[model samples]
Target: DIDVLASSEDAEKVMDHFSTLPTVVDVTGKGHTKTSVRLKGGIAVDLRVVSPEQYPYALHHFTGSKEHNTKMRHIAKSMGLKMNEYGLFSDEGNENIPCSSEEDLFKALGMTYIPPELREDMGEIEAALENKLPKLVESKDMLGIFHFHSHYSDGSNSIAELAEEVKRQGYRYMGMADHSRSAYYARGLKEEDILRQIEEIDELNSKYKDFHIFKGIESDILTDGSLDYSNDFLKNLDFVIASVHSQFRMDKESMTKRISTAMDNPHTTMLGHITGRLLLSRDGYEVDLDKILGKAAQKGTVLEINANPHRLDLDWRWVKKAKEMGIRIMINPDAHSLSEIAYTSFGIAMARKGWCEKKDVLNCLDIDAIKKFLHN
Candidate 1:
């Protein structure tokens, strides 16, 4: 449902305009203030017209999680006011209060503005009341990208092509974490292939004056809680992202232990897709995330928030816990194609949903700072 507000004289004209839209196949219902239509795509859309004064109230009421609306109404009632889709009014039949925007509404209610994304009734209201809400991370804060694939693995683009695109996108550095040897299905690179890739990266690094490409690999975690490559092989790379590509059915204890073992490796720079979940499709493997988080904190290993829409692993819900444990997060696109690289925005959303600030994200760091952290 979409709600719009117009002057009394323009109400009918607004309704008429919607009725004539080419995509609207049929007007199912029409009334003075409400109209429903079915589009050619067979989706029903409803539009509710209201007085200009009620726009903010209606927007607030409709764009809500049920609990958020309920809490808002309760706050209104406690102040001897009535709040509904129509407007906020005094209980004694006084005139409506003017609310020009969501910020105005929140101000009138004596609370700080809460972003729509944070309106999940998950302590956001209380945080707003206490003036303690975090300043969320934004896309502009990201200075580099750390986890991307190349044609050497399953990716569609070659190293140089991906680097050019990354530079075009305004990032200062790119980490090519192509699939490691054990991921045979992805054509994971052999030892010789990695050596050649490094040589290629060195050549590219010389070609670009401002952009740097970090030689990294997404090494697979073996079944017995070890990395795919030997320590000597792993140490040759700039950084390593350890992940689980198989053994999805391991028991929770074993799975947690497996990840913990990987974290214990000094060469394991970050843990990727901790849960292995595919949104709206396959469920993530079971593991004690709290235990894994604690181990990661102890080992000084970073955690990855896989940005692929299909697998937003390290789900937003755990982001707070990860932050509280002092674990730095890397919002990785896990991109296989040039277009998929823009999926980093989705990871940024998940990070914000978890109340992440600029300091909480690793890619927010500049190239020199990132190098220092990686080497440390």
Candidate 2:
């Protein structure tokens, strides 16, 4: 629920502003303190106005998963306090506690501040109490990105152009993991094409002393649990990211087997979009992710958090488990265009949601560190 706070004098003005929005198809309800609207895309939005003094409490109470709020209320009850949207109160209902910010509210409850992304009742409260909540990964920590495409495949830019853009964005390094030969629909690179691209990358590396480009490919994982390229071919590249772009209809057992086989490949540096899920569109193919995570850990394969907004795979729910299994993660934009490269921020948010710290993300490392990790 989206909660808005404003002074009593501006409540109606705020509601009026929303009512006049071009995208609002209909104003379903309006009241002294609440207004609801349906957008052009059939998405419902709610706006609630509260006093400035009660703003922080209302924000905390509403910007929560029902489960988290319930847990918080229970904690308050045990502490001889009563919590509500307005504010925390004494059990006798005679005193109102001051909560000027979310931090104050958390402090009042005797816990460290919890980010909204981690407020899904997923052990965050307990972690906060113990003061063990992860220092979550942020966009500033991304020193480089991986799994991007170029005109060598279906991308809009050339290797030189994309590399320059990456350098412009303040990243120290970039990996060009264009689609491999088997992805004919995407104009995947052939053996000869791969050799030429490698040479071109070498030329660019010589030109730009500050930025480095690793020769990589997003090789397709075949139906029988084999990679699209031979080991001899894959060994020539700096790294490999194996992904499933077809044969997504396999049963759970088969899909799990397919991914496990890819992870076991000696040249496979990472696994891309583990579940093939597209948010709000397609459900990721069904597979036993536990098995995949175990195999990834066993093989020391880095799992990817596809940074594309539409495909933030390796869903955050499995992030903590992956870390526990000793698996590291890389956040990749999977960029096919220059603008899409900025999608790394979205991936970082998802990483934080998974309780990931800087140490858990592979791309947060320097180029030298990444080279060592990939080589190992």
Candidate 3:
């Protein structure tokens, strides 16, 4: 239960009950007035108490986006009022004044109207004037990364280096999907090499106890509708991100057929870089997206939102359509270097453009959820 308290005694009672509850307890007390409680079964509760004159305005300011609160606070200060979670105060020291509502508070501040959805630092102040702010997904909300490459393929970093980098970037986990055997030009892994790599990844896990590394492969979809590796090999990996590497010139129907066969496989957890399209360099493949997305949704496979600047394929234009059709996306940076990890932001930007939420991205799942999706 979420309890927005009005007194310190009431908050103490709730905290006392919650502290003794089974499972877990996390408390964040910012000051005398603001205390946040996270319960054992994943419930978050916050409590605050303020003077009557400051209550409504304080409530709105606290339960707002950081961007929204910052802009509003600035506007309030310009009008000689101080705003914070505990209360709003007149800069002129009129403690007996009565400001009872959020609308009234903003009106007193003399700022134009703003929407909550657009309060994500996308120039909402200017947009609020023109009424054209875009709601964007910031980089911090993503839980994990789906597709990444390393020294195993044409990538420039080692698995340990890549894992450390993602951890430093504050992600829960990252999946390593170096190229498969069919990508011979990139020195993709053979079965023996893959086994060795998995062992190494396991060894690394033993070394770093706080994070996880998924043993995934970016398996190529052959021209004739078959995956690069045998089914037994594919099943052994944690996840398989299948993509079109060569034979990029097939006709529309044949191309569709090739992808269809792979999507039919339960072991193929995701379809990589749909359309195989490069943003400005090369023309993307000509497969029918509607048919592909439909099959993928039905087969329970994810579609990769390739985050490399050159190949932000899947266009994001079609992402809304895919989401509406019930197809989940895996936001992948296809990272090959430390700097490339930031590409996850690019993917998030595109996902927001497509109207995707945190739940819509498959990689946002916990490690257990990801494993469940792969094995199912």
Judged by lDDT against the true structure, how good is candidate 1?
0.89
RMSD to the hidden true structure, all candidates: 2.8, 1.6, 15.0
lDDT tens digits, residues 271-317, model 3?
Answer: 99888888667898889888998898788778889999898867776
The runs of at least 3 residues in candidate 1 whose Cα sits more than 4 Å from the true structure, single-residue gaps closed, are: 1-51
Worst 10 residues of 3 by lDDT: 111-120
Task: Sort all candidates by lDDT, best to worst.
Answer: 2, 1, 3
Q: Model 2, 1-376: lDDT tens per residue?
A: 2344454557888899987899989999999888898888888888888888888888888888999999999999999999988899999964989888999999999999999899999899999999999899888888999988999899999988888899999999999999999999999999999999999999889988778999999999999879988998888899999999998899999999988988878998999999999999999998999888988888888999998999999898887789878799999999999999989988898889998999999888998998888778
lDDT (Cα, tens digit) per residue for candidate 1, span 267-300: 9999999898999898999899989988888888
Please list the residue runs of candidate 3 whose C-alpha ends up more than 4 Å from where it truly belongs after superposition.
1-137
Per lDDT, the best of the predicted structures is 2
Taking the candidates one at a time, how many backbone clashes does each contain? 0, 0, 0
Clashing pairs in 3: none
Q: How high is each candidate's TM-score?
A: 0.90, 0.96, 0.65
lDDT (Cα, 0-100) at 85 in candidate 3: 62
- Candidate 1 steric clashes: 0
Could you tell me which residue pairs clash in candidate 1? Answer: none
Residue 367 displacement (Å), model 2: 1.1
